[model samples]
Target: MELKFKFAIASDLHIALPETVWDHPSRFHLVEFSIPALEVVLSHLAQLNLDFLLLPGDLTQHGEPDNHMWLTARLRQLPYPVYVIPGNHDVPTVESMDCFAPYYRQFGYKNPSRLYYDCEVLPGVHLIGLNSNQFDADDGQIGWIDRVQLDWLESVLSRVSKDKLVLVMVHHNILEHMPGQASNPLSKRYMLDNADRLCQLLHQANVKLVFTGHLHVQDIAYSDRFDLYDITTGSLVSYPHPYRVLTYERDRDAERLSIESYRVEAIPEQPNLQHFSREWMGDRSHLFMLNLLTKPPLNLPSAIASNLTPHLRYFWANIADGDAEFSFPNFPTNAKKYFEAFSDRPPADNNAILRL
Candidate 1:
């Protein structure tokens, strides 16, 4: 049988109403435009005849009940079916965490009590949305998949037909998008705590495509070990504000997936959203760059770190924008090479066609 479908992903929506808006001086996300940016994307998508929309996670500015309510209500108004999972920001506290599955119950949670679910979105397409938000022993949230979910996943995959296409959607990344991402102190939080176990199950199940968010970058990472592809979308409230539309086709001959990414460049409040957001992130990049320089492998002296921070002002912004290539010819060899490694390695981040 031949199968084809089109879908859209708008991850890390971080939807915030005016009353729920909060501020932090050094924060990377711009929650102020979340609502408007989503509206723009939804308006555009409504015209696309999308099979469904997948919001991988971070559906609110915080785990505020109001924000969740607002997002669900808005999602209901859309013409297409929508599915969501929980991000760290979506369920920050243990108290609010239980409410996530219920609030968006209609989206994908057939069982409101459980945080994850598997459903057949189309005739031959299966979507498994996993909740990665978990509270640690100290009640602080972490990105992880519990053993119960793993066993449940194994059972579900065992029942699935090998000819059907399985698409996994989770909030935390299962593959590293950056160099040393899984082990890097600064980036490990965005990655699943037990990614190896999850990848094993995915590989065994022959699941090829995984959708994720939370790192807030436009990246498509492939794992040779698992033979899986992780397509992570950037935040709608962050720099360049990207979302994706994908087309998947399968026939007796072959299968292919095509990806196209779009950005919310301007809203009424910000005429030139891309330019403003890039500058907004650049203004806040100093401390982030300093941390990168002083942490782990680099561990540069404070004086040298400060000197290099200015030179890398737009480094992360370019990364978030995707398909970025970097060079710092005048900088020290180690620093230059280290920064360049973050560039889009291969296959491409923004747009591409892949054989499956």
Candidate 2:
């Protein structure tokens, strides 16, 4: 018999109520649209007849109790089951970290005491939700999957039927979405500290798909050695606010997953949300662009970095919008080539079908 299912992924919601909304002049997130944007997406999703919805993480604006409460109440009204994990922004502190699982108990956190879980979302299909938030002695949060959870995952994978379809969800990227993402100083923080270990276990179990968020880019990265795909979705609170709908099918002959992405083009207040958000990101891109120009691999001088920053104003916004093809005919050859590498390299970012 053939097996098939449909699901949606709306990641990095950053849901904030009116009173909970805050602002920073240079912040990338236009969080004021959080609630309204989510409403728009959910309303559309309600008509899709989805089997389930996966909110990979960053569910709230900043781990506010009010925001969490608001999101939980809103999700309770949805027609399909929702599964979530904790993003660094969702549980920013040690105190908030301890309450994450219980607070979201209804959404995949079956055990109030445990932060990670594996359950059969459908017959012959299993879903694993993992907690990637960890705190240091000083209580500074880091992106990591502890040894205990790794061991638990190993045990779980060992027991799941080999023929079953397994889908893994987490808040941090398990594969590199950009060039040198795992080692680049500015980008590595968005990646799992021990991604290799997790990848090894998944590869061993033949788990092929991973859903993630937090970096806020719409990119599909593949691991050649492990034969795994990391489908990372863009944030709803960022420019070109986006979400994804995926359909999976399997039979004796072959298995395939088709991906299609959508953007929230407008909201009541912002009639041209895409235009507004793209400019919003560009207006604040100077400092960020400078960091990239001055960082390790490039290490360009301050004067040169400042000169190049203005030319790359829409660089990140383009990346966030996904499947970006880049060209800088006016830039120095080395700098031009380096920046161009950030564009979609293969297999398409926003839409494609994967054969497994």
Give per-model TM-scores: 0.98, 0.98
Q: What tens-digit string does per-residue lDDT give for candidate 2 at 1-356?
A: 47999999999999888888888888999899998899899989998989999999999988998989989988899989999998988888877777888788889998979889988998889999999999878887788899899999999999999888999999999999999898998999999989999999999999999999999999999989999999999999998799999999998898999999999999998999999999999999999999998888988988988988988999999999889988988887878989988879777889999998
Estimate the lDDT of model 1.
0.92
For model 1, residues 1-356, the per-residue Cα lDDT tens digits are 79999999999999989888899898888899999999999989988989999999999988888888888888889888998888888888888767888898799998988899999999999999998888889997788899999999999999998988999999999999999988898999999999899999999889989999999999999988999999999999999899999999988999999999999989999999999999999999998999999998898989999999999999998888888999899878888889988878777999999898
Worst window of 10 by summed lDDT in candidate 1: 90-99
Displacement of the residue 165 alpha carbon in candidate 1, Å: 0.5
Write down the lDDT of every candidate, Cα atoms only. 0.92, 0.92
Give the Å error, residue 189, model 2.
Answer: 0.3
Give candidate 2 misplaced runs (Cα > 4 Å).
none
Worst lDDT run of 10 residues, candidate 2, spans 94-103
